[model samples]
Target chain A: MDFRKKLAIEPGSTVSLADINPEQDGGIESKEEGKEKLSGILDEITPLQEMLYAEKKHALLIVLQGIDAAGKDGVCWHVIRAMNPQGTYVASFKQPTEVEKAHDFLWRVHQRVPAMGQVAVFNRSHYEDVLVARVHNLVSKQVWSKRYHEINNFEEFLTENGVTIVKFFLYISKDEQLERFEKRLEDKDRQWKISASDYAERDRWDEYIEAYEAMLSHCSTAHAPWYVIPANRKWFRNLAAADIIHRAMLDMQIESPRPTVDIDEIYRRYHHAVREA
Target chain B: MDFRKKLAIEPGSTVSLADINPEQDGGIESKEEGKEKLSGILDEITPLQEMLYAEKKHALLIVLQGIDAAGKDGVCWHVIRAMNPQGTYVASFKQPTEVEKAHDFLWRVHQRVPAMGQVAVFNRSHYEDVLVARVHNLVSKQVWSKRYHEINNFEEFLTENGVTIVKFFLYISKDEQLERFEKRLEDKDRQWKISASDYAERDRWDEYIEAYEAMLSHCSTAHAPWYVIPANRKWFRNLAAADIIHRAMLDMQIESPRPTVDIDEIYRRYHHAVREA
Candidate 1:
């Protein structure tokens, strides 16, 4: 299936993680085949990103989110490795600093959005106001519920100001997660990835799913859409993501900017003086 | 002379524009020699900036201020051309947008300070509060005068968070500015840069000088010292600015971060999986 057609959450449609298979391989027959397709997609993305940077007229924001071990980092690393580091920016949201906490929730996120002709990837973004903030009773239900509309309006404002937003929810099943956790235990280099809270959070998986379902339903607008990528197979997850991002760039109709200066006139005027200098 | 030592405004000392000659060209004997030294400085800056971005621990903010055609843009353009575009950020302060005017004067400037492991250049910075606001009587004397201390404290807070601040006041005489404006009128490519307001602002040169002198004297502190650069000659301005910027980066003592993951162990665990994929 074309992942863009299959994966985009239609506006007002309810989404359930249980109905979506985490094991789907995006129609690629094998891991090797998927990797090859992903590499091809990467080659396509690099030049489009260069055009986006050179044009200096539009901004692209990619928001990555997932539960623990859901491949957010893996997808960001694999996919963005294709683009020039000069034009690609990554802002990983951690626990809010005291200064950030003093401002409104979107304050930090808004400040870090891609400037004109730039691409900024948010490791976790304003959606966390709905996810972790909602899940932990950090605020009242009414407050979290109101944030969906606020986020939609804020994103609309950004789009009006030339930012294009793409969001991804990496969907991994509990069984697959346990298998990855087991691997983490056995691999010395990966042990740092394990935390007691990872298991604690895993136990609350159903609650998170309900929260994600509401988020996917409420905030998935035409201007900024969310893609639900199957994450049990890491290679397939990266491939499908690469395909969606490439399609979004194609949708943007990106063209490089025309030269600002009249080069011939400049040469005509300054040619003799330049040689003396 | 070391540009850092020569240019820094000694705190608590009264400043007089008459005491300094804007036409003075550091100690460089010739423009060609200055340009060669600038190229060498740029070569030194590129690697240091790379180490800074990799280190992800410190931030540098360079603030430029001057009258019209004092070469704020020139200094920023020439100095920053040496650094990696990925790691260098430029925030040019134009007339305040409505939203910016709604908040405290420093609100927009504080938002644009450098983040960790980044170099942020402010083409015109918060110093405008002292200069333009004071010159035009935009704010009450009580309000604008009190902001100098507030700004000093705000900058200190940034320093405590691992930021190094450098401020430059590009000092050029009224005669030099008029000559430059005349040149702008002659050059078709530069005509867009000239405005009726440029001439109007030129009439207030002495008021601007007094304002700048006060700003240099009152706000120049040991931590984030101000440099009053004699900027009549473009070549000398670029070289002296580059020298001071290099000195600031050197003081940062930036070093690349150590590897986070154990390479040998990652090799041991992931080698087989990598081969299969």
Candidate 2:
């Protein structure tokens, strides 16, 4: 079996949130290496992080899409944890409101786009239009199919206008998902987390996968290429995501915008303001 | 003179962000205390936050408005800094986009409201429709005058549906503001922060204050009372605001939602998941 297949077994042929840990499993050595690599990456990007804040020039949007139990929240929480809180923002797009449905598909997503100095994370993201909507027949096949092109164009506009996009697709198997769902049922605290709707969604897993694969094939682009992460191994998933984000920040040359004044000038201004006061 | 007045005497009278000592400044005793208090507040309302999350209940809309350099950003940075990062969001409104101007006054503001268990902050808020837009003649007296009732009703709708609206007007004296503005101009690093437009805004100080007074009188209801913070002193501002939020969270009774099963059951689930893996 390949590394992905071996890691898949780590979750016990079941996909549970509790099962996804990097340190205890010892299955994904790459995760350990990824954590160490993060420190170095952070050092280089620290300046860029500062510049991004100072200049307030570009907003970054990261979109995470995956199968049920695909670890979207876990990856997001761990991946961008290293960033300066002031410079990062996370927006999870949930089920649409009455107001949201009245607008175009991109309306709600656009309002939460991080400012130039901010990094924004979209958990689940616009892909739902294709994934969920496609699988459930929530919208006509024609209506949902048109969204892929619309999404690409929307991302292209954001990228051209200084928004950097990083998209990730957390890939997990159906067997693994069933194991996770059963675990959720069995665990009391976690029992609250499961819903009948989740099972209803799970029943259509194959259709969802087809929708996702089609999304990956169509929407992945140079400006915001979608990284298909084998998320069966929780540790590897987290480590891989952190590495991808760290590299993206570096690749973008993220830096603090330089203020017009230096420390000395600031000191002078303080004194003058104090003296005048 | 009060400490606020005394502090206002010194132009650019602010401590370094790094050097801020809450205890010495008579705010909270220490950063840890601040953290504890914040966590306590979160713990108290966590249940509500979760319910909001589960039900995807009302969207929260917090409005922060103040004079030039009156610590709107500072309050935003710290108040939200302590929030559960996943559930808290901040939106700083700048010049309106062409698309935004094409819509009604609440168009942009409404779009950014936090969905269920989340906190959404408006750094400048929709009061601008009456305050800045009124002062600048961006909107007519009739247009701006009508916004107060509209805003009250808008807030009423949010509150009626479970959204808690907290509005704060950071109150800073003209002398204090002049001090801050002058400091910004003299400090090379901060010089870029002050634009020609900021000075233009300063010229209409009285008009802005008048607009604010009208707004405060009209909109400060029991449900969404506006707290006029003494903001010349940054430490006090942070502390006072923290106290207010803590109180509000207590009122809301935030707490982590209880699991359906007992603690032992959860432990068993954890153990079982591990064993099965």
Candidate 3:
């Protein structure tokens, strides 16, 4: 199955978060099977990423957005880590600083977008403006409402300029979020990841769902679509995100540029150097 | 006199490079008068720059394009230096490196554009993709022609996002360029800047003028218009550029942002610290 087509939120279609199942596993029968598929997909991604770096014709931007403990960081560790670090960068957006708040919302985000031959992963991205900002009334409705249009224009501009953007909305049920929160508390190794605010935010789950639905419906453009990933099962999320990213890289069709110098002349010079040595 | 109005290439207008006098001095009678005016404008600009940095509402992007010895560097030294270096940056775009050539023409340029509350002066910029690229036949007509639209869209996008772009085509006569080149050879301090290509490029002066005229005509838009500064007289170039830049900043109307904290509460805390000390 082409996960890119299967998972993507259709452009211009309304999305109801309740209708989608978070536990859907893309037909993988078990966690071990999913992990095996993820590993294979990751192996395929390494060379494709190198070709992407060598070609330097296109940039890949992977945006991951979800509620607390929806595996945004997990996708980075398990899926994105497969790509070479030299050509890939991860930018995380949290609360805006004074300097960032002073400009238009996109100013800080634009600075972090990848250049050609690179992949940028946004752990929590500009979507937070709509998701978190909308849920908390951080800005007036008039302000945040117009941002949907601005974001579409910005994404369209990036796509036209050879950036391929794949946004993943890591979907999880409310119960799954509570379960993950409890797991974080139980695991001393994962205690740092737990925060009191994570539980507090659960109270606004419905509001957040409304915000996410609006974001998915409005900002999903043909050039840059949002993918709703079933992320209740961590292993399945990793496998699906890895598979989708691998597919996107393949679609770029990147190839090394034609040699600008005379290969024969360079080869002759190299032989002369070897003889002298 | 509004130098911005006098110097700007009207949007949607054709340009005749020969028709505009490169020796035009903006009606300033002597070097002393122009220098004095420039100095006054520079002084006024310092405070405005602080407010700009504090407000963080708008960014200033100044693009300088000119032939060799047309005083592109002179404008930066004499005018742009007036702004605080903390908030100002000078990015010089020379020959594209192998890595830069790998990406789209605008990729490197986009990365260097100013963020909010900052000023960026491009010593030589994306116009080279059109000017030098066209005059030297570095790219085909089809490739270079499409860039005019691309550049306009890029500039429009920047403007919509609160960047005020002021592009200056430092206009100079062929005789003036030759004179300046000779001066460069004569002055030991300036001898390093003298290049064989400078003389070679002069042979294509007419072609370059055609290329530049096309650029000015096509890419000049309402949001980011091109200013053809008469640069034969170096002092006048400095004066006209400084004056125009001052006018543009004034138009931005950047006031310091309202304090985000309570002044009374902060004062009380400050007093408490002082009392404890």
Candidate 4:
């Protein structure tokens, strides 16, 4: 199945969280089968990512947005990890400090956009201003409402400059979130991830959903589209994200530039250096 | 005197290198007077630069392009040194490395553009693509010719995003360049800067002048204007550049953001912490 087509929120189309299944398996029978498919997708991503670095013709920016326990971190570890770390960077946006809040919302975001020949995965991004900032009333409606158009313009500018942007909105149900929270509580290694605000934020789930829906409806564009990935199932989430990324990279059709120097002259010089040694 | 108006290349207007005097000093009587004026300009810049960093509202990008031995580095050391080191960066563009050559000409340049609240000075910039590359026939006419429009669009985008761009073309005569080369040879401290290609490049001075004139005519826009400084007089060059930069930054009118937290509440909390201690 073409996961990109299956998951992408079409430009100018509104998305309803209730309509999409959080438990989607993409026709895979079981956990073992899903893991195998995910491995295959990761394998496909590795070589394409190398070509992306070698060709240096295009940059790829992957934006991940989700509520707590929706597997944003899991996707980064399992899916984006396929790319070489040398050319891959992950920028996680948490609460803004005084310095970040002083500038326009996109100020910090633009600084982290990928350079050519690289991939950048935004753990949370400029969308947070429209998401958390909107839901929490951190900024006035006048300010946050204007950002959708600003974001569209910014993304279009980046696209025109050879950055291919893919955004993922990880979808998970409240029950699944609770389950993950419970699992975190049981595991000592995951205990650090649990915060008192996690439970407090869960109470405002409906408001966050409304904000996410508005973001999807207004900001998705042909140049930088949003994807709603059913992320309750970890294996399926990894498989879907990797598959879409690999397809997007393949679409770039990056080719290494033709060598600009005279190969024969370099060969002769190398032999001379070897003789001197 | 409005040095910005006097020095700026008007958009869409062609320029002639021969018509402009590189020895013009804006009526400064001597090197000592010019140095005193430059010091005053630096004093004005220090406070404004501090406000820019505190406000975090805008970025400043200064591009310096010139022929070899034309005092680009001197301007960086003497003029730009007035700004605080914490908020200032200087990126010197040398010949492209193999990795850099694989990407578009602007890719390496865009990576070094200032972040919000910062100042970035490009010692020699993307103009090299059109100047050196065009003069030497490194790229075809079809390729180099299109870059003027590309550069304009790129600068316009940066300006719209709150980056103020100011480009300088340090103007010097052929005879002045030869004199500087002789001075460098006599000064042991400057001997490291002397290279054989500096003299060889002087032979193609006419071609380089044509390329620079074309660059000034085609790329200068209202948002990112180019200034041709009279660099034959080194002290005058420093004074002119500093004066222009101070004016441009003053125009930004950057104000520190309002305190986000309540001072009274912070004061109470501070007292409570002191009592507990």
iRMS, all models: 9.3, 6.0, 16.6, 15.1
TM-score of each: 0.57, 0.68, 0.51, 0.51
Candidate with best DockQ: 2
Per-chain TM-score (chain B), model 3: 0.96
- The whole-model C-alpha lDDT of candidate 2 against the native structure comes to 0.66
Model 2 spans > 4 angstroms off: A1-50, A53-57, A76-118, A129-158, A172-190, A203-219, A230-239, A254-277, B1-48, B82-87, B96-118, B134-150, B172-191, B199-214, B232-236, B253-277
Every candidate's DockQ is 0.05, 0.17, 0.01, 0.02
Q: Which pairs clash inside model 1?
A: none
Between candidates 1 and 2, the DockQ winner? 2
Docking class for model 2 is incorrect
| TM-score evaluated only on chain B, model 2 | 0.77
* Model 4 docking category: incorrect
How many residue pairs of model 2 clash at the backbone? 24
Q: Which candidate should be chosen as best, given TM-score against the real structure? A: 2
Model 4, span A58-81: residue lDDT tens: 999999999998988778767876
**What shift in Å separates residue A205 of candidate 3 from its native position after superposition?**
43
Model 4 TM-score relative to the real fold: 0.51
**Weakest 10 consecutive residues of candidate 4 chain B by summed lDDT:** B268-277
- Clashing residue pairs found in predicted model 4: none
Candidate 3: where is the Cα deviation over 4 Å? A1-277, B272-277
Q: Point out the worst 10-residue segment of candidate 1 chain A by lDDT.
A: A268-277
lDDT of 1: 0.83
